[model samples]
Target: MSRTPHTKTPETAPAGGKAPDPARRSDRSRRAILDAALALVGEVGYNKLTIEAIAARAGVGKQTIYRWWPSKAAVLLDASLALAGDAPTADGRTGLPDTGDLAADLKQVLRATVDEFNDPAYDAPLRALTAAGATDPELAARFTERLLAPQLALYEDRLRSARAVGQLAEGADLRLMTEMLLGPLTYRWLLRTAPLSHAFADALVDAVVATA
Candidate 1:
């Protein structure tokens, strides 16, 4: 079957978990590799995805992948980062979208997030990543460090701004507040407890602001 423009073959890291510098790779090839990795992992799960399969799908040499990443987990990590709009800075800070109105800024950010979670492109790969993280401690830690924590820090930055402007309750635990803002939505997504929708986003915003 011919691959769609969106479909690309996955890539795996080298035997020892070494990877190449992404900056040196062609942007098109890198995107192809990441796309392939995500699609393969989503379709076959991580264990069944091989470097050969990914290389074939990506139209790249296995050595190219081996030169860059040390393991399949590393490729998935990089792919997930690409899918999520790049990793936050090394300081664990990716500043939130700022529009002066805290509520609007947050609502806008969350809405975009809801859209990402709802996207099929994002959903399958994310699910695969979550599944792998469940059984692999090292992969899980890297996943948290590379993907989850930085995203959470974006929320932290927004909340801190709200606190600074007195939009939040004085002395509010920003960490807990950030959890309150995100935990329920994640709960719904992970557990299928309910539908995630714009209505849910509005409700979440209301609940969060009411407590602020």
Candidate 2:
């Protein structure tokens, strides 16, 4: 099916009749911008981050950054969303896996999440987003709506499924359960205290599952 990209992709004509394949310049620039933003946040943190600095680091025009995003918070939010887009679940969606054993599925998810929490790529941008969220309520709302809520919904779905199949107790508060699963990892990440490893993830899973 013939379709159009939302943004202009580079289309070059090599003195020929047919247009060359789309170059995906918009996508590249967007990625570069995001990379630059995340790196800057890591180096100097969110408050000191600036559009010009991001453009300079990305090797794109300042106007390019402005054309795509309004503020640093918006850029961070989009970057997080973009990363989430690439991370598909076992079902090819952004969510946890279901292996009949809720504990196992949750452990697998948390293990991977622990790795990401330690990885600089995710750690920096996530920390920046949280910092931005603290200072800017509007950005926080958008971040929650765009990233947090959807992810929470996935856990909710999984918990609901568990309940239906008698894996979860009757009238268990899925939302609180979701928080219990996520809270520790996020807290450890923010604290920068210990290594976020599979071991820690396993412990969290065991702790939460013990209560269940």
Best by TM-score: 2
Q: Ten consecutive residues with minimal summed lDDT in candidate 1?
A: 8-17
lDDT of the candidates, in the order given: 0.77, 0.80
How many clashes in candidate 1?
Answer: 13
Tens-place lDDT digits, model 2, residues 1-212: 33765544343312333653344556678899988887888788878889999999999999988887888888877877777766533236645788899989988888878777777777777787788788889878998998899988998999898899998788888998889988988887898677678888888888776666
TM-score of each: 0.82, 0.83
Q: How many clashing pairs per prediction, in order?
A: 13, 0
lDDT of 1 by residue, 1-212 (tens): 86576543343222232556344445667778888999998899887889888888899999878878887888888998877774222222348766668778778767776776787777788877888888989989999998888878878888888889888888778777778878988788777788889778778977887776
Error of 1 at 194 (Å): 1.4
- State the local distance difference test value for candidate 1: 0.77
